[model samples]
Target: MAGGFTTMKTLLYRLFVLAILLSPVYTSDHSAMCAEAATPQTAAQKQKAAAQAKKKKEADKKRAQKKKEQVKKQKAQQKAAAEKQEARAKQQEKAAKAQAQKQAQKQEEEEELKQAWLRQQAELNSSTPKKEVVSLINIGAKFGYAGIMDKMTNNYANISRPNELDNDYAYHSLKGGPGAGLSLTYELQYGAFRFETGFDFTYLNSTSAYEFSLMRRLEQPYGGNYFYITDDLRETRNAGYVGLPIMFGAQFSRYYFMAGAKVGYGLFGNYKQRGRYDIVVKDDALRDPYGLGIHDVPTLAKDQRKLSLQQPSVSLCAEVGIDLDEWLQAQPDKKNKKRTKPGERLPFGREHLHYKLGIFAEYGILNTNKPTGALPLSFNADDPYPQQTNSMLSIADTRVNNLFVGVKFAIQFEIPGKVARPIPAPASAAEISVFDKESMTSLTTAIVQVKNTGNNRTIMKPKTLSKGVIRQRAAVGEYVAMAKAKNYYPESVAFTVDSPGIVVPVKIYMQRRPVFQVKVTDKETGAALAAQVQITKRNDKETAYSMQTDSVNGLSEVMLQDSLQYALHIEQIGYEAVDTLISDIGDKMHISLTPIKKGEIFVMKNLFFATNKTRILSSSEEALEALFGYLERNPEIRIKIMGHTDNVGKDEANQRLSEGRANAVREDLIKRGIDETRIEAEGYGETLPVDTNDTEEGRQNNRRVEIEIL
Candidate 1:
């Protein structure tokens, strides 16, 4: 940027210097032309006219500036294009690389699995398989929450006998977190069975703190002195292990007998600092160690080395589960060869099997140096003696034992369809058509004639997308109600009976409706109206109603059967009638009908008023005859009466006239027994006009009163 700015400045200075040097030439030319003009030569004066010359100079400067701007814009566009192209190329390269890597990894795994399957198949084909007719796959979760894995160690804390640390040892259980596992299996000849394998891992980090009575050390010393732990030493089992267990089983019908072993080599097992040391030296009747020497003498203290609680280890287990259902399925009779087709696959019908729950038990063989517990339970508080705070119990030298007990739940399923195949797809449309004996080539249909009777315009039109693409184009579900009466469908040839002979004919529907559905309204007032809407059809007597416009939507659609001279009428509560035919649809058919003034106001056709008077005259009885007819035709013709008077007399008279006229109309309507429940009357006296009141003709036109459909 700095370099560019410097270059620009240098160029500007050069241009300025050149312009200054050329100043004399222009001045000299101007002086010569002026002097020649003063000599009265009309040719010279015309050659350099002041206004023309000035305009030409300004135009030249403007042209130069515009040219510079164009060059700059072109360079900018080129730079942007280059950047965009580079970015696209890089993105494409990255995507290709990632796709290639993914494909390669998938292929590698597939190849490996393929090879393994081949090996299994070869072995199976070479020998008779050991058969076990059973079914069940049960999983279990074992939590090491109550027990610390055991380890056999030569540490001081592990003393077999309380006072015989040098002679023997004992082991204490380690405590930890929770763990779980999963299993898989299959059915065999005998009963229910499982080939289960799963993983479980946990961590146990415990804190130990203690306070003990200070005691004198070195008996008979010259000066009596009390001894205390200078620092805290802790024993924390923050170790963890992942277990892999695989078990096999056999089911004696309702009796499930299972035995499988799981071997898990210790992933990692170790101890951390946080526990104080515990010694029996002071408590022992003999204050000193026994004659036999032991590296760690018993002394209840908080200072000691954290025992190396870590060890590479291995363990094994066996478990069993059962299902209580004793139901046995009956065998199928052999098929008669004469009644069967050759090369037909065996039926091997689906198994409708049921299952029940049962109990389970397991046992394990402990290994490694730590004092591990065979069972997940503890005698009390998990420590046999949790009150013995951070003190290392003299348990390392003890003998360990195996465990076996407990019960759990189980379920079974007889898988359907070989090990894999699922339901196949149904026959194709063409095949179904053939079976039905219907024509493969069906008819086309349009929906231009089917108009939405919904009131809301926004809800009427299909929503188009941001880029103008219809993301969710309007569509009718295939479950359209089919009946014989008023068959307005199959507008275009796209929809037709695919089958004509068998059962009900199958019809093919189009993705998009072919008819141009229109919502008509008055362009001047944004109002809707009723018209003699026509939707020509090939079958004219199909009972199809020409006027589908309801109170909600002033619209009707058709397939555009013949000429598109569809009549349109703009009918609103106050506007006069407008009748026209739409022939030109420049764009997607959004036809707006501009209503020419048919009447000054919209008075209810069924409503009436006094003849030329504001009184509620009784003779105006039948003005609403047609209105009643309309109500009979449309049960929901809600209406209101609006009265207007021309500018005359005083403001109060005009107002009274307007109000009286409206009331008179209402009264006559009520007299005809039109429901007063559906009407309200309002008067606007001389406030609006049909034309300008500046002339006598315009005033006369405005002086008249009019009725309005509110």
Candidate 2:
């Protein structure tokens, strides 16, 4: 289009220039030649203009169509982008919601699992049946009397010379002496079963008596000689041994029994003997001739004998004992004393010390006597012939065993076991609080009892102070807390002491008991009437509470439990008595008593009867008694007993029932010491109903017995 426009402008410019040049050459005929030239050029220029205009129009139309297509394509791309973004956003929202739901479900499952675990732990803690096994080291001392059964036999052949001598010997009584021991034991205990092994040092002593006689002949210048000797010997023997004992036993409450074996090696032994002897000699050549001989001669005979105890001794040992720790130190004050701490040694404050008083026996299973052939007595004149004399044990031919039986007292210092140390468990602080459930206020006077559930032991029983809180230290375990106060129902709660050094809070809320306050007054004058008020549980004969209202105030108060019914009886001299069932107990009750006068009606509110019958039920005793007492106190007053019934049956039947019920009351009063003449019976049937017979309560009220004073 631009090139066509430029060509057209050049043609116009050349035509103008040719017209100017021809105007000068043909001035005379310029108009005629110009007109002809203009005509032809105009025709050609018009044709070119039409073509260019058509072409420009076509170009503009094409550009408009291309621009419209671009705009439509851009709008289409924008809509697709928007749709994609919306889809992505929706997907993100769905994923986020799913994730949130999954998280919530996971959290809920975790919570449920946690609650289940807590319940399981609580149940396990409450009913666990296994007792902990304990190991201990005990250092102890024991003292007792030790006696031995001695079996002795004399072998004269081993002690006497060839045929030149005569020998006689007898072994007499053997008596035991004191025995003392020290022990270090390791003990393992599981429930009632006990195992103990340790080292022990024991010392024992005994005394034995022996008698011997010897006669010998001597050759002399006077031809013959005779010698005779008799000796009594008492010997004391001492032995010390170091032993290892393997014991198995059981402990039952405060008593224990142990039976085991002790392997002991004799560390030392010694003996001493002292006594007197009588000696006489007769010679047939001189003394027989003179018919005289040496009489009794006393000579002191003393010697230290050698011990012949074997190297090693095995004994069967048994002990039956009561734990003296349960008795000797059973005093509460002693038990409450400060205990010795770990790694501490206190002379008297060791709480771990256990004492036992027992009867113990050790019978030697292996012969402890090792004898070398030697004479029990020495005839040599040399002062102390220690080598010639031997212990009676060495000369005895039979086996010798040791037996010790006596009361033994022992004090054992117990060392904490690796397992037992875990017990008497770690101490944790507990803060217990008591509050009134209704009022949400502290109960300062509440008594809080904390018990360890595992052991069923009461750990603390304390009355709350002004703060209504008690702070105490308790072992780490499950516990139950109970709170009680006067005029309040007791409350209990369960809690756990899980960690040491942290306070476990226990809150107990107690409900207050219902209180019954009664005021008695005269019906006419409203004057206070002193009355005897006796309250008993319904259907129970024993009085639940009894009190006398003062004449001045006519007030009596008693605290009673909820969800129970009581029978109330009130009586005053010269006034009608009241007997009623107290089921809906409120804060206060007012009673207006009518004086014993003519035509004053008193309803027996507590009286009960059998269904559809006139027979009085046993529950009506209180009402009958009240009426009887009122009649008795006002002896001169006569009473008329009237009965009424609800309209539930035929009129004739109702009338008869009422009449029978009234007569029944009269008879009961008569039997209870009221004069028959003083009581009259009448029936109103359904005509004199005190309340409507429309509802059950109204019907119940309509059926009643009333006493009329006359």
Candidate 3:
């Protein structure tokens, strides 16, 4: 790690040195521009930088937060940057604790927004052969002439054969009807014996280049320094090829002659070595060959069989031509034994180049085999369906008869083309290595839309996005025209969606609702009992959705439907008050408190007090205790407490007795924790209603203080 740090420092130093070496003016200028842009709110860039640095020190342990894109929407009524860097610096930290919570219960409006960024990329590869662009330039195009001769059109390259060529030797011999296939010549220094392909008007679709063999067309030389002769004439029986022909010219001084021959496989294309022939054919020509029907016809197979129109078969053809006036002659009969003029004649073999045009006769032998009997021309018992397939005609114009009888009209051209070379295979060590791709750890997210819920539409920039932001966009515009759009959502509705099971604090607009309210009344004789009431709040966002209830007229005036169903009850003496779920509600609501009228009230006998003393015995603890809750229930009722006394003392003593007794009773009620305002003590002085006190029991009853409900 230390080495890495040192290397990083060195790299930084090198970069700084390189930066200095470049135009410092421009670099400094760009730095100043960035500084100014970053300090838009400051008078000077330095001041802003200092402020930022100071703030950074204060925010030492602050963590960064990731920002999320938020979009919100609503029904019927809907509503829905430069600080960008600052926000990014604090995004992750902010989102971690980010929340839209409302503190007050007065409003029931909710809005949320979240935003996130996403990125994606793709690539593809393969392990197959690469595409190739072929051209002959790699080597060179095979040079050759490909065309058919209708009849050699008065050209020196014309041929004339009477026996086999129908009379019109011009067309019948050259173009050769279905006989002329193609004339393709190739000289390849390398490569294989490819198939000879050409464009034939008779069959033009065979356009592929096939491999050809390196079969040399040279013949053996007999004497010391011998010239090349046709292979068959040199090798005799050793060479069996008798169908395909390869023609080339040999020149000596002013005389030149064209010479070539045909070669082909044995019958049924049987192997010359060790393969068995699958099928066989009759040897009507004394050429016993293994193969199928009419296949063993080499003794009569035509050289121009590929042409199909005119057959140039079974013979050696030689023609002579001179630059101006040359001559062609036959070989000595002692050595070869063949001629066009017959009987050791001197043919047009060689001469001087003095004539403007030279014409010479040509000869072709069909190499036919006769049966030593009259050659059958038709089917018979000895030779049923006899078919004479070979024809040997001597001395005639044939395949390579170049008897120049007129001026030659031709042009020489250089053909630029391509040749194919076998591509070398790659080595095993050159193979490519592949590895598994890494998975994405950062989350991918995007905002579908943002909606504005305010009276006026507001812009939603990337940086100013809130976690509770809501917005919806529309494309309702004509071409090149403004669109019809407005802010969405009304403020009066109160609907919200929160994360399941958890409610975030939020502010929302809502209509007011009736909570709980009640009026007290006496049950026994239908009288009003003004009772005290108390109300309070409970939830996550706020303490309550409505007002709190407390000691009052047993009725609460507030705006909230939740509080209506809250616990509500009233208490009173001699009454089993009802506790109800405050459910029924309309435009307004009212509830009546009924007092208990069924159960009887407990009565306690009173006790006499001594003169002038206001203290009561402990026995008074039991006296009027049942009525303690009664006074507590009716807190608004004010009543007077009266006292009576027996006639056993002076008038002043009696008055004191009344006052003392009344005071004693008042003290008793006050001691019972009743509101002093509901109790008024009065000394009646033996004037108030009293039970008969003449007897001792009546006197005891008459000694009781009278408590009344005002």
Candidate 4:
């Protein structure tokens, strides 16, 4: 940018210098031309000059008239061309609209036919019964091998035993045991997926043999050192548990797969030990310094006792199986005379049975670790008392987890839950037609609601008319038919069907409803803000009609009543809410909301208190909840409640009443779990008046309670 500026400045300087140099020449040339024109003329020259001027005036007038005529002719041609173009555009637009209407009519007819067919199929399904049997309750039995996984570890060590180190050992091996359970599973199904969960009396048992030895140090005479070992020659742990399994699986044809977890409680446990060991003593000055001390002469020292196991053990199991009942059900049984078909339930006192055989595997994911109350032994034959040499020890540990992998066989009884049979109907058909009165055309895609008014029951759900007609079996009755569609007013027609063989035509027309839209903006800044809008029918107060608007654009498409008037209510926090009446739907409406500023008070238009009391009315619940939600959203903001009354009562009574009302609002908010420090309450009675107290409207305005943002 600097270089460009410098270059531009240099060019401007050169141009200035050039203009200065050419100034003298320009002035000298101008003066010479003036001197030549100032020279005097004779009488003959003057006469020639006057004649030339007369010719020039006539030429100038002719040229001006010619230019004006040319401009008028060009404008006339341009206007004619513009008119032609506009006519062509109007013709094209009319053709396009006609084509679009034709296509829409065709699509509507096709949709009407599809909807009619679907309605007929639904009615038929509802009237018919199933031919096959579905299982409602199931009872089964399952048995599998339970493998005890002994993941031995010393996560906890004994601080009392100085010679024993807990973590210096490892788990060698584990073994599997027999397991069985009685299952009573109730099946919950979702299409092809099935979930099974129930109580089971499961007996889970396993045995584990592992090696985890502890270290011990022994002191000899004459400042000597020695070592002792509490070697586990052969140790066995057995445990039993009762478990509950909740499994989910999917079945495809005859094959299935399942995966889930099982929770169990420990029933019993047994711990057994059989081992022998010797100690190695080291001394430098004595005879036979590398002495091999004999501990109990390597005899069999058997210790068998009951072990305590942790409760509520959890494991995950998976299964894959096939239904054995499918093959059995496929076979023919000549003994049963009421059998209808293959895979069908037989009549009379007969029940269907299903059998399943599957392989399963379960692995315990939690650690069941506890201490074994055994001690490391030290032998000293040189001591006077040989029997008192060994003492009870601490600091040893063990862990036992479980894993089961085997096969399970189950037999389940299925009870049928559905009835399926066909019903007879009339062969002939009757027809109904729908129409549009505004366009004088057959209306398609308009749904028809059929009600048997004579019987006071709905004969059929709303079915769309196909090709502007509905064909169905007719009964000898009077029926009310209603036609409805989006953006169209609903119309109903009553007709009678005398017989079943003939086509009964009933036509109904629908009127089009106009679309309405509204755009909301801020009154002061003309900026858009999200506003809550509601439209309620004047006579029917039970149902509210409303639509959500975009927060950024503050625009919404609202639904309006057909002929009835409605109240449109729109509100935004920190602004005054507005209410207006809408007689009919029209173009987009532009509405502006007045924003409330800090320290500016606004009356709560909908909030009402009892007569001369502070208790709020039930109709004010929605307003209070909205206020609470606003406070929750704006945590840092604070507000003050100010109450006032009209000047009709005693001054002291009025002041006390106003104060009570203001304080009541504050107390209610505090009870709703809002912090008391963020709110303040005050009352001015009739002191700070908003309007004159002479008129009723002014008094009503003065009796309002207001809130000001602080």
Candidate 5:
């Protein structure tokens, strides 16, 4: 039995070892099993063994629950770590993207800044200066014809002569010559006008051919001089002159006109003559019973000689031509662009490029007939030379008048600088309302006409209104609006649009207009003239109605407002434009227009100057504009502007001020496109007063400007 027990113990030990090796749970509970194995017991031990087995089973369950809890906690910790790593990676990626975007934006902004700087620099380089003084140098060459105008008649160099015997006769004919000149002109431009003070080295060669003859009866026959004898001489003479011209020129577009006086010095002259003479001799009274018998000895003497002429010559010069500056060509699209400066390089191999080509005519106002000395003729005195005895054969019949006509070419070079640009018309909008002023009601049936006064562009033609309001886009400029209705007299208003995109409203009052007829007649003659008649509101200078008189009758009829003050403006091409305030609209208004002739004076009442200053005022704009228009219409007419001042200041100061004021007006006219040569400015100061300067009213009259037609 002991042996059997030993075997079971061995087997149990082996089983315990196998369980420990095969089951990790059993190995972990080995301490509890060892404690149980060390205990010794009987039936209580058996019951304890059963209780222990139950406890062991409960411990295994508790351990398994703890292990499952630990495993779940570990898995949760691992998942949290993985999530945190993924979040870190995503954050790094987001930061990198933001940095790249920031760099890109910064680069773009820098590029824009660089471009803006470049543009700013370009603007600084390209912009022109304002109101710069321009210096111009002009050189030209010219050639033309010559003519002699003789004031003397009936003696020598006359075109008409009597056919009777013993009559003194002379004839003169002009032959043209070549002229060349080099001019250095220093010009100061005031607007479109230029005041030029220059020296011209002009060489002129003028040729005049003349014939003279005289016959007479001698008192006694002596030394073969029996009958009277004279020589019929044909002579050709050349006169050369060097002149200096002082001129004023005006430029309008490409065309320019200049008028001035040239003071010339006669440098040298020469003459050649050939003649036929009838020599009458007594011949000792051959075959005659008395001594009264004389022989007719006629001789044809053809002689040629050189003579000299002299004097200081004065001439009037005038030129009309076009400037061939490529920049001066009409380009409406590039009107606002920067103009080609004087020093700017031009294309087409052109240098010194301001070229002018035109026709010029000069006439000597002074008689160019001063003989330096006499030439002794080489003739046979023994044969009785009657032509040499008379003083008429020695430079007496020669008359010379300098005249020239030819093409002139000029090149102008200018200094580089800034200049004031032309002021353009202001941009504006028109808000037109057609309404009855007295009734304060909108006239839906009224027609409105809107026209731009600057360019004479028809902004809106006469259109019947529907709602009495119309919005039209227009440039900044002066405009005329006319409203017409059936019963209400047509009303017109001059409105100025001063701002861009802003609407300017014009109001015209309607009233019962009275029909008036105007009969235009010449002041000197009772004849009619073709004229344009404009009836305008006196205050605003707005044309209420415009009509043209019949060319034959010179009559225009229009409806006019009786209550409103009115002014009449009459314009004709050959007559001075008249602007007069109408005192009475009735009585078959007989308006007289004066013909614009040389020496006619027209007072410019509205030309304004600042106190002791030469600057033009804005208030005088309308008047100056009217003057400019008048000048434009009469392109051939020349005017002299004379300025006067009240005798309040010193004579010298007043003179300077008056002159400056006159020049200021001239400059303004030139700016408006009047040519410089067409106008001349002078100052009389207090020297020539129109009225007494003792009273303020008289002084106001004395302080005035006048324009004389020349």
Candidate 6:
């Protein structure tokens, strides 16, 4: 074994050496194998890793691209939304600006109207008068006829027997004579009413004639005889009286009438008489010789008497006359050569001496005759000369009244009374200035007036301002200062004069009226058209101006307030009416009107109705008037009223509503004096639409009432 071991060792050594050498080869091979195996696996892993990395990179790129696309889309949406928001904000700002402008214009108009009214009132207060009472005295003289009226009755009888006859007679005649009177009167007059009281003196004269006769058969120693005697007398009477008269009357213009009572007392009366008479008698016993008798007889002395009047008289007196001063003043006074002040009276002027001439009458309403038991005629036959007496008034059994009628002349003097003193002007004056409102420039030619509001009297007359200013002296009171200039609105300012010497400064700003030329033309042809243009205040409907445009120029010029709103209406024959508001006066107005003809359609823009109903509102008056006027101007034209509605309700309901609206419009035209046959009504419910019904604006356009010429 040892040997074998040695041999094997040696062999092993060699084998070892060989194994070593092969080991290197095996190591190399194994290493190569491991390297090959590792190479393939590493290569496969590298390939798998590379393929995975590529796939992941591709997925990351795809995700990143998708995210970019999403962001882009989001950014696009944001841009669109921002643009929409910006557009909406711009629209709102534009609307707000328009509304503000409209409101400002309306406010300016109202202020101007108020200023005009104040100036008008100030002018009316400066033109009125004053009233007072007066006192006067009058002295007058009168001449007239005085008469005594006596009622007389006479009884006479005649008896005839075989041998005796007797007769008696008495007669008297009285006549009136001239009279004169003097009077002094005091008078008080207030406006048309007057009172007068006075004392007067009168003298009267009268004349009368009296006759008496008596014949009696006397039985003497001789056979039957007849005796007769007669007497005649004439008399004159004078009377004087004192009287007091009280009168109340009214004077109308230059004429006056007074009626009252006059009480009088008779002071004295006297009478005188002169004349002749005749008598005759016949005797039967002396028939053989002759029928003889006394033929003529007269009183031994002329009858005359004087006595005091015993009765007082009360009489109703009335007088009517014209103021002679009024007529005298109208006559030329050539004799008045004295220079007189503004209100001074001339030395013999009729102003202080009022002369009146009037007719007056007085009647005594009491009995003046005294009755005594004395025969009218008396005679004594025994004496050679028979005595006879006559009393005519004593025999009368009635009352006697005295009457006087006369023309009176009177002169009146007005007694000066306490004169009303005028209110003194203030020591200090106020400056009133007139200026243009827009330019703040002074107006030199502006008329300035200052009025005292307490008395409504003008403190200063309307006078042209000097250098746009006027100094006014006013009493302590409220006052108004008014200023006006040509082509400018009048203005008034109220101020208070608190003290007598306060110097107040008053400023009045006048606005210049805007003058505009209005032109009307045909819409289609752009040609001038003659039309009637009417401008009215928008608030009160008061017509401010009305005129017809010139036929050639179709132009009318008018003054308008820049601050006021006005309604302008233009109309012409065979043309559609134009109604518009004039809110701005920056330029001349150009109104274009469409011609009315067959197949022409016009929307009634201003027509308004009650909510959801066909009843017309009062605000629709202007529209209705325009339509009526158009129809009236063209009598031969026929029209159709068509109504439409938005598509918001049932078709049937909408149809009914549209029909009702159309009929309402038609009926309104008929009521406004249009012929019923000239208008026809129809409805198209949502079928014929002017605009889309989806939006609110579109729906509003679709719902309309229009007139169509037929």
**What's the TM-score of every candidate structure?**
0.29, 0.39, 0.18, 0.33, 0.33, 0.35
Candidate 4 local Cα displacement, residue 560, angstroms: 99
> 1-710, model 3: which lDDT tens digit per residue?
99999999999999998877587797888899889887766666778888998898667534221111122222212331335556675885666545322322112211110100000001112233233222111111111212121111122221122112222221222211111122233321111111111111111111111111011111222111111111111000111122444434543545555455433222211101111111122333435433322212123233421221123323343334453322322122333212111223232221100221222221224422111222101122322222432111111332221111112211111122121111111111111111111221211111212223432343223221133222322222111101111111112212232222122222222122333355555555455544433322222222232222233433445444432334444444444445544445322334455553322322134344554465666655434553565676666666666777666557687777778777767777788798777777877665653567578877666565665556
Output the TM-score of candidate 1. 0.29
- lDDT by candidate, in order shown: 0.42, 0.72, 0.34, 0.65, 0.66, 0.71
The list of candidate 4 runs beyond 4 A from truth reads 1-145, 154-162, 166-171, 175-178, 201-213, 217-232, 283-304, 329-351, 372-398, 419-710
Error of 4 at 678 (Å): 99
Query: For residues 227-323, could you state the per-residue lDDT of candidate 6 as single tens digits?
Result: 4434546556677889898888888777888888888887876655455434334545565423344433333343334443546777778888888
Model 5 lDDT per residue over 22-54, tens place = 897877697688778766556678998999999
Candidate closest to the true structure, highest TM-score:
2
**Global lDDT for candidate 4?**
0.65
Better of 3 and 5 by TM-score: 5
Q: How many times do residue backbones clash in model 4?
A: 3
1-710, model 4: which lDDT tens digit per residue?
Answer: 99999999999999998897579887788788777776555556888988999999889988989888988988988988888988888989999899899878644643443343344446546645222324434565666677656543446344234445444553454566777766677765544577877766555565544344443334434434444444444444466667777988887767888899988787776644455444555455565545355444132232335555666788887989887754654332336533322224444223345667888877888755454544434335443112321111112444556776777777665553332111111223346777667886877788887888888787768887767787765567888887887778888888887643345777777777777888888798777756667877767754367554566787998556656767788876667888887667765777898867778767765678999898888877656665665566568879898899999899888898889988988888788878999999999898988899999999889997788989
lDDT value, residue 56 of candidate 5: 100
lDDT of 1 by residue, 106-182 (tens): 55643443443444445445565334233334333332322343333454321222212221222233433333233
Clashes of 6: 5
- Candidate 6 versus truth, CA RMSD in Å, comes to 32.9
Q: Cα lDDT for residue 627, model 3?
A: 54
> Candidate 3: lDDT of 647?
61
Per-candidate Cα RMSD to the true structure, in Å, reads 27.9, 32.7, 41.8, 29.6, 41.7, 32.9
